[model samples]
Target: MRRLLPVAFIVFGVISGVQCGFGLNVTVSSFTKSITSSIGNGINLVVKANASIKIAADDDNSGTIRALIAVSNNVTTPLNRLLGSILAAATAENVNSDELFVNIFSLVAETRPALDAASNAASDLQKTTKEYLYQTLSGNLTELSTILTNLTDGLDYLHLQVYQAANEEYPVTSKNITIFINSTVIADITMPLEAIQNYLTHVASVITVIASERTQVIKYLTQMNETISNGLRNIQNSASGFNRTVIDAYHRIMAQQVNTFKNINQTYAAIVSRASSYNGGDISNLTMFLSDLVAANASFLQFVSLSTNYTMEQINPVLQDRIAAATKTLTRVARFIANQSAINISQHANQCAQRFMQKLQQNPVVITRLSRCIQQDSNALQPTVTFVQYQMDLVRSAASSIANQMSKVCQRNTGACARAYFAALPDHSQVIQNKISVIAGVVSNDEHVVTGRIINCLYGTGADIIENALLMTKKFNRCMLVGP
Candidate 1:
């Protein structure tokens, strides 16, 4: 407390102003009053400086005590704000992560229904193709049987003509005539059979080849679709659980930080309160305490600034990028699956029908007369079975091309999709490592700033101010500092 100044000023001024005598008589009352006022002014200035330090040790009306009274404030705002900001940032980040997970999960769910539909379409296409094979062969067989009768009648007439013409030239033998007639009938009858065989061969070629290819494609599709759907579903479940754990940890980290700030503030405030009551009417300790308080405020501000930098520059930006990448990659994978599931081989059915119809229209083997076929056996009316073999080859080649092409495309697309999905899931390790490096640096820098700069500044400022009151003259001290 600064009680020494006013009393010393009044006593010294009166003692110096009165003439030295056996009987005490005070002569310069005005001079004593002027000296006391002058002394008071100087001490008042020092007291005010002490008061500003936030810890006032003395209680008095004069200069030093007044300064002591003013030092009684506390450190508060910056600490609270620093902790609050951290909690807010953590809360926001947690919410965003949760939202991203939900979106990806929903997209994965959408693919299953589409996959089932695609499988159904494959089954329909197979049925239609099988029915076409059955109907075409059954109707064409009767037409071939009628052609056989027409050929037989023509052969008999030819034999009769030959016999009639030869009667005038030579003796006709019944056995030679019978042999010739039988041979002609056999030739005529076998022609239509060859045509029927050609038709059956081509029909059989389409049925066997096309059916086998279709079965393989559909089986591959079903397996691929099921694998993707199940894998995504598993990933979605696991990722969501992990995210919840991270979010909860983040919340706890933020809460602990806030509590740590509160504890620090309370400790310092209590210490400063104790510091103010220590020395007898001396404000130097209080002044020093106030300096440290101001410095602590600076330290807290630095901590908040650095912590914020860590989040904004390192943690938050990385989190946002991860969220976007996760969302984008997951959505892309889901879309591929859904689109594949919706892939209808039904669309290609029309193309197959159109090609089959056009081939029948242009076909000399199926729609034309037996005369249209080039004969392999000259003596017989039977057309070469070679046309039937070629037509069978053509139908087989066309169906195989379409089925194989579809299967190849589906395999290529789904294989790529599977690779990409796996790539995205395993990507988190690298991203997390990057974020850890950034946050680690920020934490180190913030700790240094808070513990080193602000704390050191406060201690250094107050440590050098010991006996600062003695720097003034005796008269100055009488006004500024109270004597023990």
Candidate 2:
């Protein structure tokens, strides 16, 4: 049961990442396992990332309103947590994917005890986990950094090799391999980074809240030279494992993405090998071209070279771009979840705090005793005060991180969306350009041979050939202006 959740989570994450492919390749479904991993991983990330959103059930739900209004209602009784209402609203509303994230957050809130086992476990390790995660997430992910670097290097090497081979194999270099290839892979990675960043920001906020609560409890007890009440400690202790579970969820999701990256790395290596080593080992898409090249047919090398160029320069970039775009959408949806979560938790916490304050107000004797203890042992109280201050600082830091990350996501996603196209222009656009250029050259070269004075004596057959070439050029020119 423990492992099953992570597997499911990875499936969601990978599936979300994979859908951002260029639509031209009908063969993209070949990566069928990716969908499984995407959903499996992403589900956990969404749940863990969604913790704060469900701080309390929305009272607007009839079930919850009825529950709250009941005289015998107890803390143990389940509240609506807005799960059904949020989902129904999501479906009926014209909101984008962002609202879907809020629905997930609401559901997580509804299932708090189930989702926040880390907190319920009452382990101090949750704090440790939060510290480490904050450090790791705030910095670079080494594996991802390495993968992107290698991908860039591999693409560069491919470009160098392609340039050297372009003249000999195809007798012309038409496409700008560097501009189209390298640029798009960057887009592929951008969306995942954005998505993960959103999840992590909320995660940091949850931890800060946990830490702050514990510190407040400690401060309250230190004034009396005593420990906090069992009830108070238990409330704080319930949060001990929450941050760790959130971190674990992120890792589970990212692990699947790392696998996806590895697959792309392998594909990149295989394609580059075709140029770098110039071997005919097992290029899946170019069986016919490989066969022709192996048979020592130089003329077929043009077809082989063009096929390789099409695969490398056009298709792969679009595939990566699509994945990136899909991830961006997934991450953008995370915002609504975070916003709803913040509202619920703040309101719920305030109510709980007010109840605590009213109970203390009714206990003048206990308040007087606590005040005397603090006045008599001001020095003894200094340490707890400092700790509370430190925790408040952590909350501030986390809030800052959330703001910064959200700002960056907005800037990058909005900018990328503004320039959106489902497929790369250079994918088939360059092909159109190449075909037109080839036809124009052919027509220009054969102008004298076809439409010269000799064509008038030859029953105008050469003239007809020239006219057809002009028509073909016009059609191809139109194609170049738009796309294939």
Candidate 3:
């Protein structure tokens, strides 16, 4: 029992030591946990307060400390809000500078309204004072002269300033606040006082001059109105008479000329249709046949000789008369042609063909009658040779003149007038050749007229036509001489 008691004591002592050590450890751990919790709570409270304040500090030490504390405590929202507010304040400062400029301009403009009103009041006062002085003084010459001189000087100075302001270069300086304020003070107070003193001394004279000028202006305006009214009435009557004369003359002369041209155009068109058909047969073949006929027969020679004389004597005269009539007809015809429906060759082929045929038929009858008359005069043809020679010479001369005129009108180049003239030349030569052919056939008993008379006429006419056509072509070269 004694030995067990000793062993139990030793075990109790060891157990006590272990229990004491565990208690000490528990006490230390509890103390540490309590201190850590208190420190963490203090840190959280400091972070929360700092976050609510949104502190902004300029120095690096304070800013860095605040940023570090904020990051460590996870207070980012407060730091960001503090940064945004600081930026907003900076932006506002910049905006205020801009607003200052606009405010300054508005204040300056507002000053002008009051200044203008005061100026107007001052002017009225000067006028009223002058009237009173004039009434009181009546005719004080010396006083009036002095006052007038002063008033004139003041007005001249003001007028000079106004003129300078108007003509000065851009970016006006006098209109600015500092300059305007200074100028207005000088003009209104300093200079005007001197003018006022002068005005007080010689008010009557100034008032009289002003009243006299005002009367003159009124009289001048009245005279001007009367003169203008009288002049306008005279102009109205003259214009009415002139208009009537012009209208009547245009209707009577120019309109009649136009109508006549229209008729001549219709006739020319008929002639062209007739001529087209006449020449429809193979001209080359006919020319060859006539050449053969002239070479084969002596009777044909006699006939050609007789026909030549007759053509010169009788046929040419009749033809000339007919040409003279036709010329007049052609003038009207050309005018009518100008007014006719514009030719659209593609769409109205039938109408064009009909018109062409009708024109051709009308002139052939005249040609045929004249031809027959010449044929009948074979025996009497010799006596009329001189007249025929004279007629041929005249035709040649007329053709030359026509060619020159056409050249002048047509331009030498590729103008429409030049084209028309050239195109017509060949056709005209053909007609002349045909006439000579008829004469030759009648006189020479040749079936074909190409041998003598027709060939001669063709050679003569063709040469003239070519010369004229070339001359007319030169006119087109001078077309550029005409100015816009």
Candidate 4:
């Protein structure tokens, strides 16, 4: 019995030691699990915090980036609009200049010499009519009428000089020059400019008709004047010789003829002065129109340059810089959050590991080994964090670099647009410039020729011939009405 009791006590002692070891091991395991759970919770909180920060950053920046983009679009839209409008206007002006150039070319080639011929014909008719009238003031009225009519007919036909010259230079039926004087060009400018030519032609016709009859009719007027004078003198000398009715009639006719002659002479002088002034005004207006075209071309070029500058120098930088700045800010904020989260997680892991090691002193070997492992994990996390940080830096750098690249692309596109615009412009712009210069030179040369010929002819010798012819027609008609 005594021996059995000792065995039972020894057995109880052994079981107690085993239970204590098991309890200690369970406590260490539970503590280690709690530490691990705490580290996991800390890591989860850091991840949540990082996610929340990113969401907040996106919210903060998106509106600003969008607004800036909107503003950039708004600013650049007008540049495009202005470019389109300016190009349209330039094209319209170029068309107008081209039409004018053709008209001027036709004028210089055809209308000019014809005008000169008409003017010469007018001068010749005037001189010949004047000399015939002065020399044969007392000749037969019928014969004088026939001779003046023949001479004036030549002058009147010269009115066709402009039309003939235009037809010859740019044949209406033929191919080459006729194409330029189409309905559109003609309607826009040709009709108005050519109207002047027709008007001058009509004037020549009138001068010829009037000059042919002037001196011949004047002879009849002189005879009537002489007869009337004789009758009035006789009536005064002896009232008994003529009746009261005859005397009054003779006096009235004489007064009417004298007034008509004086009026005709005054009208001739006035017309000559007015015609010269009118032609000068027309020339001045044409030259001014050409000058305005030059000014418009210059303005077009200036506006194009202004639009290009606004796009490349102003709008492009503003857009690229703003977007890049927003991206950088977003990346920087995310990196900061990630780094902070990593730090907080690492700290939590280290603190939990330290607590776990402190509570596990009964299992020194296991505790030491576990602590070393936890530290190694923490140390390993540092490289992961560094790698993440490096990746974030790359993202940030890429955002900025992409923005810079976009800016370069924008600049390159802008340059390409400018080049395209210039390329498009040269077809009309260079041709228009060349046409304008040619027109100016031709206008200058032709102005002298036209002035020397047409205007001077109408004002100088032609006016005198027309006056005499008009007077003669009136006198012949009057003489027939009042029998000599």
Q: How do the predictions measure up, each by TM-score?
A: 0.23, 0.19, 0.18, 0.15
Clashes of each: 9, 33, 25, 4
As a whole number from 0 to 100, the lDDT of residue 439 in candidate 3 is: 36
Task: Work out how many backbone clashes candidate 4 has.
Answer: 4
The C-alpha lDDT values of all candidates are 0.32, 0.30, 0.32, 0.29
Candidate 2 lDDT by residue in tens digits, 111-159: 4343233222323222322344333322322322233343334334433
Better of 2 and 3 by TM-score: 2
Q: lDDT value for candidate 4?
A: 0.29
How would you encode candidate 3's per-residue C-alpha lDDT over 1-484 as one tens digit per residue?
0000111110000111111010111111122222222122222222333333322322211122233222222221221222222222212321332343234334334433433332232243232223443334333323323333443453344334433443446533423322322334334322433332333233223333333322332333333334334433443343343334323432332233234334433433432444333233223333333333333233323554454344334433433454344333333332222112121113332233234323322332112222223233233333233333443344344334334555457554245554455455545545544544443344333212322343343334334333433332233223213311
Highest-scoring model, TM-score: 1
Could you tell which candidate, 1 or 2, scores higher by lDDT? 1
Name the regions of candidate 2 deviating beyond 4 angstroms: 1-175, 178-183, 224-484
Ranked by TM-score from best down, the candidates are: 1, 2, 3, 4
Q: How accurate is candidate 2 locally (lDDT)?
A: 0.30
Quote the lDDT for 41 in model 1. Answer: 28
Better of 3 and 4 by TM-score: 3
